[model samples]
Target: MTSPDARMLASQNIVLILCGNKKDLDADREVTFLEASRFAQENELMFLETSALTGENVEEAFMQCARKILNKIESGELDPERMGSGIQYGDAALRQLRSPRRTQAPSAQECGC
Candidate 1:
């Protein structure tokens, strides 16, 4: 990626993690975990790996990204009012308003009971 792209993404504080290829057993086709980790250390981004076939580490990767964003927010490092800010708690009044429940058909046993 170009410097401008990196800067733009960084300005938004979006966690950009590179997942390398699991196809190569030699582990040189793409960026490895070590390299991503180093990059994360330098750029203050969250780094992780995931496998699509086995469905491994995918959840962990998302959780790691969420935790990093939350940590930045908690530390006052990121402003929630910013456009790219991911911290959306929504309006309190919206939560207070409840949706109407749907009616369901009951079995014959319910009528006797």
Candidate 2:
């Protein structure tokens, strides 16, 4: 989390997914599933094991990430209108109200999803 690259990627409230690659070679794994899962949990990232050859969990991973990103947008945790979030919504949605304290989660009504 302290790495500069990781910080940069997370700066815009971007959702992060951690995929452990090479699932087809489970016996030859460089990192175990449990270890990677623990790391993903500690880093607060969505976890998946994928195999390009087998096409395992690849689409599901993308779908899960997209779902969470949309949820973040709906929940007002992310603002695509803000610069550098790399997100855009086509339809008109009312912006979420900013709380003065910046501690409380915005209400669903407030977000206007």
TM-score for all models, in order of appearance: 0.53, 0.69
Tens-place lDDT per residue, model 2, 1-113, is 32548757665676788888789997898888898888889877889999888999999999999888777776777777887676765666533332222567778778734
Q: Among these predicted structures, which one has the highest lDDT?
A: 2
Clashing pairs in 2: none
Using TM-score as the measure, which candidate wins? 2
Question: Tens digits of per-residue lDDT for model 1 on 1-113?
Answer: 32557666556666555554353344554665677678767765555566776666777777877777666766666756557665554785643223333256667767634
Q: lDDT of each structure?
A: 0.59, 0.76
Error of model 1, residue 74, in angstroms = 1.0
Question: Model 2's lDDT to the true fold?
Answer: 0.76
Q: What's the distance in Å from true for residue 94, model 2?
A: 14
**Hey, what RMSD does candidate 2 come out at?**
7.2
Which residue runs of candidate 1 sit more than 4 Å off their true CA positions? 1-3, 9-12, 21-36, 39-44, 82-87, 91-113
